[model samples]
Target: MPDLLVEHHGVQVLVCSADGATIATEQDALDHLVGAAFQGAELVAVPAGRFDDRFYDLSSGVAGAILQKLANYRVRLAVVGDISHHMGTGTALRDLVREANRGRDIWFVTDLNELTTRLAPRP
Candidate 1:
């Protein structure tokens, strides 16, 4: 079974299944998110490495599944890396990611400190 890792991003940032592969099925992804999203941790980082290598490329269904799961939670997600490489490949995918990012709920940031400001507690 895969394990979840709570990392220190100057604050608590739970990273789910660091060594786990990209979710094989939609159900598996959703179930995992249910347990992974809320760790009582203030910040949650979704490392591309946690998912499939293709996550950057996002050619597989895992990408969409992950996004859908995040939306269900109505919670924000922080991606701790640069996605220019993948986004550069296709206009559609780039647009999709860019649009998704436009919403404050999803962030693709290179630094973790930025998370604190973006994910501040609602009250």
Candidate 2:
């Protein structure tokens, strides 16, 4: 299945299929970013399963590189799916998820419903 364009609360989101290409490198991240931007998407919703395992390992720097690139391009991102397995006790991944969620630029949500709620208009 290919990535899809969807709308939630008036926000255009590029929702990547869970079975789509695995994002394991900065180039892969850029590919998604470019595609989303081309489609005029305000955000990119990527399933957690679409990411490579290295993405969950903070030391690998894959997450930071991908996220920073997206932020630099002013592209919002929502990682949609449970990532609890990656968040072990005292893990940097957990801290990263917490910090990212506090901002509008990036988020780690459990599902599309959560993403929808997050995309709802703010008062």
Candidate 3:
């Protein structure tokens, strides 16, 4: 089971999972992540260790479901923690994600501070 943490910033973040096991499937992962989002969470931090670039494509139903949920709620999504091991290495995606890291939309961050800073109310 994934542990979801509701923070003072009005964003509920899911960190680590029960049994330290990586979720077995994309379907289950999306269900867990989206459920957490519906819980009044504005942002979600899922470790990259659990999912790969296979999770990045919208063509994948599981990924599509997550993107749809993020768009529907206008919530910012952040997957914190190192994904390099899970994804090997790639600056292109890193740049792509960095560009999307902030806006009125979703963000995939590698650091917790970056996530908190992004979630802050803008003036």
> What RMSD, rounded to one decimal, does every model reach?
4.5, 1.3, 4.0
lDDT of each residue in 11-119, candidate 3, tens digit only: 5665545344353354555566656666766666666665545565434455555566556656566676665553345455555466666454666767778777766
> TM-scores of the models, in the given order?
0.63, 0.93, 0.62
Error of 1 at 70 (Å): 2.4
Residue 33 CA displacement from its true place in model 2, Å: 3.3
Residues 3-41 of candidate 1: C-alpha lDDT, one tens digit per residue: 444545244566654565555555655556545666564
Candidate 2 global TM-score? 0.93
Q: Residue 6 error for model 1, in Å?
A: 8.2
Where is model 3 more than 4 Å wrong at Cα?
8-26, 56-65, 73-75, 85-92
> What tens-digit string does per-residue lDDT give for candidate 2 at 1-123?
787898899989998888878899888988866555668888999999989999999898999898888888788999999999888745699888999999988999999999999999989
lDDT of every predicted structure (CA atoms) = 0.60, 0.87, 0.59
Q: What is the lDDT of residue 61 in candidate 1?
A: 59
The TM-score measured for candidate 1 stands at 0.63
